[model samples]
Target: MGPSTSAPRPRSCGAPSAGVMIPHKTKRGEAALARLKTYEGVPPPYDKTKRLVIPDALKVLRLQPGHKYCLLGELSKEVGWNYHDTIRELEEKRKEKAKVAYERRKQLAKLRLKAEATAEEKLGSQLDILTPIKY
Candidate 1:
């Protein structure tokens, strides 16, 4: 055989890159992760202001502070919680947000009805076939 033509395999045990490494879990963190993993969706409980309880969530989830943003992003992707759904779910227990959402929904319904009525009026005004043509 002449010189080897195949490229060398990349090293798995390479030195760390410039970015910070993931923190190793402590005993408590391991236990917390186990507990948090039991849930199916939206890992944390929301606070009264309809925001996620980040610190508490991370602590319970056994995630480092640096990983919070990424965790939430992945969770949203996996759970498919859009803005309105998230807001509604987070504030589900709050009457104020529910009332606000109800008012917005009513306004949207009125707008849709008005649009439909306008479209019907325009269609009605159009001359039907066989009508006498104006000179």
Candidate 2:
């Protein structure tokens, strides 16, 4: 509210005379602390890795074929359309599918083993139950 400047606002604490420094031991302060969360000594609502599908990202890039898409400001345009989270999500999906496939294979192996054991047991008992059927 002082003067408009091009630079971003700097962090400043409340004035001691304004009674803004509420004691942390108070219930109101505890409630306020519960409402706020910090990570890495920073407040919540942090910038994080956003998830986006590759195809959808491609569509976004194609929609605005001018703005240069950069990833973490480190890698350049080497990746097609700079689809960051899309490839990651796809890889995760692939791994999930593989894991499910492995689990199914394991279950099938167990079922097959059980079936084989049961069949062997029935065959061994068949000779005793159905002796030579004489006419």
| lDDT against true structure, model 1 | 0.47
Q: What is candidate 2's lDDT per residue for 1-135, written digit by digit as tens?
A: 234533221111112212345565789876665554322212223222233467764756566778665432124224222433554566576667667877998999999999978877878967566558724
Candidate 1 regions with alpha-carbon error over 4 angstroms: 1-93, 125-135
Compose the digit string of candidate 1's lDDT tens values, residues 21-92: 322256764554444322322334532234445675466567655764444434444543345355445546
Scored against the true structure, residue 89 in model 1 reaches a CA lDDT of: 57
| Candidate 1 TM-score, true structure as reference | 0.26
What do the candidate models score in CA lDDT, each in turn? 0.47, 0.50
Index of the highest-lDDT prediction: 2
State the displacement of the C-alpha of residue 132, model 2, in Å, after optimal TM-score superposition.
20
